[model samples]
Target chain A: MHDKTIAEISAGLQGRKFSSVEVTRAFLARISQFNEELNCFITVTEGEAIADARAADERIAHGTAGPLTGIPIGHKDIFCTRSIKTSCGSKMLDNFYSPYDATVVSRLQDSGMVMLGKLNMDEFAMGSSNETSYYGPVRNPWDLTAVPGGSSGGSAAAVAARLVPVSTGTDTGGSIRQPASFCGITGIKPTYGRVSRYGMIAFASSLDQGGPLSRTAEDAAMLLQAMAGFDPRDSTSVDHPVPDYRASLDDGVEGLTIGVPSEFFDQDLDSEIAALLETTIAEYQRQGANVKEVSLPNVGFSVPVYYVVAPAECSSNLSRFDGVRFGHRCEDPDDLLDLYTRSRGEGFGAEVKRRILMGTYALSAGYYDAYYLRAQKVRRLISQDFHNAFEQVDVLVAPTAPSVAFGIGEKTSDPVEMYLSDIFTIAVNLAGIPALSMPVGFVDGKPVGMQLIGNFFSEGRLLNVAHRYQGVTDWHLRCPNGFE
Target chain B: MDLSIEDVKKISALARIEIEQQDIDGYVRDLGGILGLVDQLNSAETDEVTPMAHPMDQVQRLRVDQVTEQDQRELFQSQAPQVEAGLYLVPKVIE
Candidate 1:
């Protein structure tokens, strides 16, 4: 049903053949019949997803279910679930809610999955495309006039419109592999403190991560093995050690190697994404990989050192959206600086007030040493050019963008053509590494991806080289055309 | 290098926000065509460059000033706009 996979819908709900309330009522009737032409949900939770699919069909009739118990997913409204409406899509959190949850939604509701809504993004997550969001621009379920790549463009258009088999996004820069390469799907991100950001919301906390947006790569390694581990309320999480991301799924690629960076195929790429990344690096050299080329020339200054370190850490994690606390305030405020300037000028939107005025003019005081200490020393020469190309490639590939899905508001009134569609995903979030994206081709008709990356807590060897290039590509089982 | 509308009204009053006067001539022509491509990172040449904040240059593990949350201050100021006893009310700023 909708081409199964999420370990075949958690082995059809652990073999009873069906039930998690009929797969969460067939994904809430395909998200109420295609989320109003793909605005890709801002809050759907259909009656708390049928009471969390009747409590995951009574925890698989008491066997105490697990491998994502009843599976359904979809989160990206910048985490924080609690009483639901966690609007990080912002009109200053439209109506707020969140009494708690986000430890990646209580570890995907402690692995019984099923939530089924929240999605839409890019406000505090600050743009790449989901047209700055404030709950609008999400479209690209493969070309309903393009433009999905974004602040996890509604979890890559609800896992490329199958509506949700796996979702949850995040990624600060290159907001989850440039909208899972303009909504073809698969996603990832991972590395930086691999997972736990307490309750998400804070955008650039040293480059926010939180992963998975799937269709495959073995369902983003089973939703990044239940949204990763370590969480002592995130002081940058990483206390490490949490493997088994579907450990080596058929680990093929004979001699591996693969790199190919030559400044990620230069001449400012996009010759149809450098000929579909040279035919997916010649199908990873006929599946035995070993490609090579490599070099990161300070990854051509990773988009001006990730726009001066993700807007100086999103202007200090959005000075706690001041309207004296909750979201969007100001009705009749005569003082307190007119209620924090008409509630952040009517709750931000315009690429979150141009990255909160280029992160308060690069942390003010005479432009913090010519733009935030020279974009943090060219972000340590772009992570010492990916620690000198992962000491000669074990993984790395590019074309995650530099063209494809350029229609909707064609470069939303140009913010440097939407920050050069995140120049090959801000040098893998400025080299904290572990990337992923997936789908391989399609140009005018949209989808493109490729990415992969790795190194530094190599997310289970980049999901075993994206599950052996999604086991010889069906372009992650193509879909999109008027939802079949 | 064009921005003036008094530098977009002094960076929209130091980003407290509120900009309109005919939307400042199309936001100073779309922020001077996106800061003329952010002034090509001002003559790229990160001068003997060093600026790479954190992608694991390590040294930031800290975890001892313990508290491990409990006062969910009435479930975090019940989304404050004016919470009472647990504080968070604004509009008097040093009388």
Candidate 2:
């Protein structure tokens, strides 16, 4: 039952082949059997899930159900769940229960999707590896010793291990795509402003965007269709038209002009991954797609520019956790200053505090123009690079990550080394464009993902292209060993 | 430019995160390494480019002055550590 894709399950539910409760129970059982080993879930709402499923069964009987009516999805633990622990994998928020639901959570609930649990992630969505999570590191389902890339490690792992059909994830740098790649599943980060940020717990407000991680593009599109839209609650949420993501999924990539950025294939990329990408592109050619070489020269500067801009925004956004309104607070204090410092110090982990400090320095009086302003201007140049590439090609193809998942604790000590893992996926966020990562094949017995980047608001086209590719390839079909 | 312990101390204080004496050395090293990584951006020429504060080019949205939110102070304060009589409690500031 866990082997079925969301589309298959949706059909089964609508056809009355089985009730939603049966599907939810099978997944809950799988999570119980495997979560102790994978550590993918932070909280499991079993009673609520069963109740939600029972309601969906009634809705189906009345013939008033939507496409995602019975899907069981996991929140990334970053999005607030009303009266539930939306920890965001941070001790700061561990004791915090939001008074209301995040826009994404409510929208999915409205769609009749059952909430399985809150997925684990990097504390405040800061780390490229899942080790920074206060709950503990999430293990890659493929190899227990290796990490499932983060900060959406648990989101990807849950879907990959078949504990759930899909789960939510937010991408700042490579949070969603990298983990999806490592876990050998599909994930998409919609255009900036495509999803509401209200109650999502801002990390870097300008860069963070929520989407879905699923076993296939069809499932991602189904989940994304429900998650994307405008919200008056989030000032940054764009009032753009939400298209039917499944409408064009079967639209073949015949004569499609696919761009291969030269910079993405530079010396820093792993040779084995490059060879695998070349072969994957050749498969597209056989399906009547044209490949063209393009350049995003300014794309290489993305990581450095992102490091400054993201932290600067984080420092400002995190100031709200001052032990007053909500969240963790110190036991006792001599003065206001003591209260503020100790509360935050005890609440945040090393990575979160380091970013806060980095942001503080960047936004300080004299350094503002040098660090923050200059990085923003370079960010413009990176966005322009994407603008130029899109003029010649319908989509740009690149490796989602430089390599397969590394062993846990390998790069935790070195922040820069960890940041480099997101080298390929950062520029897309800087440009505020939509990109999707789909499993291409494997290297060193671990899975690899190739990214499909498109111009702004082009999620449907990207999903269509990936869905067509999934039809031809079976790499995404292979589940991790011992899971079955 | 490497960040000194003094620089880290100042930054930590400004950020409102207390760093004890033992962790200052590690913070100094890691913060210095991070700043060093971002220093590579100095090479990019952005004199002609406009700074993009956000990915989308738009102005802030404004609505009529009618209040849309209800008073959820009691529910919201349920999670706070120190609250009394519908007010958040804090350390004394006045002498």
Best by DockQ: 2
User: Fraction of true inter-chain Cα contacts (below 8 Å) kept per model?
Assistant: 0.65, 0.93
lDDT tens string, model 1, A344-368? 8788776777777666766767878
Candidate 2, position A207, lDDT:
94
- What CA RMSD would you report for each candidate? 19.8, 0.8
B1-95 per-residue lDDT for model 1 (tens digits): 67778877787677787776777777777666655655556666778776666778667777788777687788778887777888887777676
Indicate the worst ten consecutive residues by lDDT in candidate 2 chain A. Answer: A325-334
Steric clashes per prediction: 9, 0
Q: For residue A403, give model 1's deviation from the true position in Å.
A: 31
Q: What TM-scores result for chain A when each predicted structure is judged separately against the true chain A? A: 0.39, 0.99
Which clashing pairs does model 2 show? none
lDDT tens digits, residue span A203-238, model 2: 999999999999999999999999999999999999
The complex in candidate 2 yields a DockQ of 0.89
